[model samples]
Target: MIEAGKKIILFDGVCNLCNNAINFVIKRDKNDVFRYASLQSEIGKKLIAERNIDISKIDSILLIDPKIAYYHKSTAALQISKQLSGIYPLLSVFLVVPQSLRDWVYDIIAKNRYKWFGKKESCMIPTPELKALFIDQ
Candidate 1:
């Protein structure tokens, strides 16, 4: 189980886009604010069940703050960006655009993600070097 304090990012395990995004966040996470779990994993499923999240309706990305609560969709993305290093924090300016509009775009991309980015036969297996950053390695 993930300890208190860090954020846990739950993502579609087989998704190429999601995997790449994880790598992106890892590279920029100078403050070490995040951990990860594939949404298909036992731990990820437990988190979803504990939060009463409906997987059929929301299976993209989830940001579980562990201390606070959870966030999804564009809110999760923007919140994660706000904690990153360099110019990423500036992307929070998009928060002023209105959530409905922002999520609409996010939804479109999420809906077509597999088609556009392809998928692995199974969930990604983190390299040995990155294992500590994952919840269920």
Candidate 2:
């Protein structure tokens, strides 16, 4: 079941870069504010359909604030950063740049992520200790 106050992060399951980013967030998430699901999961697909997101256009990351809002690409990255512990919140300052420009850079990284970071044979399987942090694992 989805928790009441946690934001949900949907990510590319097989992408090593995305997996690393999620681990980074988990380490810095002092407030326990996020849950995760792979974009290939049933819940992830359901959320995407509910939001009417075009997966062909946004294949990297997504942040869903439940009933409130959803953010994708650089905006989603920045939003997630703001809640993280330490100086990471400052990264949100990049929001001042236009979304198109920010997403352009993000696209470059996303496009090469598989080639640069490699791909998993399948979606990540959270360890028993971290299982609660994931949904539909």
Candidate 3:
């Protein structure tokens, strides 16, 4: 089980847009407030099962804050943006919009992600220095 107080981000492993987003998060997250796992990994599977979240309904970003709350889709993105450095924090303003509208935009991009950005056949192997940010299988 993941430790309480830590925030975990579960993402699509092979999606290019997702990969780039992960890299963007890592670069801007100077405080290191996040850990990551590809949704296809063993750790990811276990976490999803343990949390009792329905996998069929979860294809976008997932933010798991143990013993607190979890968020998905546009909510997850906005929440993460609030923690990032620079003008990214400005994105929090969009939270005022209704969730349905926000998620509609997210879904459009997610549905065409592979076609627009391509995908890898397998998950990314993090560099040695960055490996500690990921949970073990």
Candidate 4:
């Protein structure tokens, strides 16, 4: 279960691009507002089922704000950026760009992510110091 005030990020575990993005977020998570789970993990599958998310449609990233709401694709990315340190929050301005346009671009990148960035055979294993920040690892 998610703790109060914590947001959960569910990502493609074997994706290099997704893994790099998570590392970037971890470095800027000054507020410690995030917890992570690989989409391939049991907890990730459970959360997806609980939310009734159709991963067949959107299979990249997801942001779960506990009982409040959940977000996917570009909306999820922008929302996560807004909570990070430095000027990353400014990325939220793209929210007004229209969801259709935003998702079109997201789809292009996601479709090519594996070919462009490659992938690992298995999910990333969090280091000892970072283990507490992850769930279902």
What is candidate 3's lDDT per residue for 20-84, written digit by digit as tens? 99999999988788899999999988888888989787786899887676899999999989889
Q: Per-residue lDDT tens digits of candidate 4, residues 1-137? A: 56678999999999999999999999999999999999999999999999899999878999999768899999999999999999999999999999999999999999999999999999999999999889885
After superposition, which runs of candidate 2 have C-alpha atoms over 4 Å from their true positions?
A: none
TM-score of 4: 0.97
Q: Write the per-residue lDDT of candidate 1 for residues 1-137, one digit (tens) a residue.
A: 67668999999999999999999999999999999999999999999999999988777899999778899999999999998999999999999999999999999999999999999999999999999999977
Could you tell me the TM-score of candidate 1?
0.96
lDDT tens digits by residue: candidate 2, 1-137: 68999999999999999999999999999999999999999999998998999999999999999778899999999999999999999999999999999999999999999999999999999989899999867
Return model 3's CA RMSD, one decimal.
1.4
lDDT of model 2 at residue 122? 96
RMSD of 2: 0.7
Give RMSD (Å) of candidate 4 vs. truth.
0.9
Per-prediction backbone clash count? 0, 0, 0, 0
The lowest-lDDT stretch of 10 consecutive residues in candidate 3 is: 1-10
